[model samples]
Target: MIKGLFETHINVSNYEKSSSFYEKLLNIIPLYEDRVRKSKFYWVGKPGESMLGIRENYPSPLVQRQHFAFRVDVEDIIHANDYLKALGIESTNFYGDSPEELMVFPFMPAVSIYFDDPDGHSIELIAMLNDEPRTELEIMSWKDWNQLHTK
Candidate 1:
């Protein structure tokens, strides 16, 4: 049985840039910042809970584009979207079908919005806030971005 995910680490070329971007996106302060190896780690949740790290290490000084996602409350999804927009960051619709898009295979209890970091690594922010019992398929079903886009 899987216990839970502790944190995710992604390699990048620019440490400062990536660190700033993630800090803005996650809206959480970093737990630690190591200067010896040019690496910056941040806490995704409350202190002592869990954390994510962004290490500066590109293949050839180029941007490292990988794929990753984070889980959020369903009610907070809109706020997240707004936050991103306010920062001038644009996220691609998942699946690309109509206004609704599919980000990835059936992740349960949430929906994902596709995006990328400075290095072009694919990133996703998943929102989970449904009161009703949900199946992986149901929660992962195609979502109408148009509906969410409207006021």
Candidate 2:
């Protein structure tokens, strides 16, 4: 019954600020907004592929933050660091290494980078690589992953 993820929600301290940050970074236009409740929703990709909801109901410190990722094209993942840099967003490896340290996961055979939204939630842009999983490779930089495949 479940083919894929359809929707997910996260908490942000302020609706307007969080919405604006997402709008500028992701270039998303929310489909719905509740002014009184301070809630906003946006389609992460195609209208029905997935929905991302941002709620500004996090008034107390007890509210736990969240993390989410958007699947993108491999090319997009490769260039995301530069794109994020231009927007003044710092991208990093899982280890908090350099921004150029794009990541490759052998288990999932995917490439991705890590960054943060205004609310400090870990945001990732990932793309499945067109390769078989080599569990022995473990996790490493994208460049290293490619070199091994070439050899």
Q: Which predicted model would earn the best lDDT?
A: 2
Runs in model 1 lying further than 4 Å from the true structure: 58-64, 96-109, 129-151
Per-model TM-score, in order, reads: 0.73, 0.92
Candidate 2 positional error at 78, Å: 1.8
Prediction 1 global C-alpha lDDT: 0.65
Q: Candidate 2 on 72-147: residue-level lDDT in tens?
A: 9998887889999988888898778986878798998998888998889898888999999988777898889889
**Pairs with backbone N, CA or C atoms under 3 Å apart (clashes), candidate 1:** 65-121, 66-121, 74-128, 94-101, 94-102, 95-102
> 84-145, model 1: which lDDT tens digit per residue?
77877777656643223443233343566776788888877776544333343432443432
lDDT of each: 0.65, 0.83
Residue 119 of model 2, lDDT score: 81
TM-score of 2: 0.92
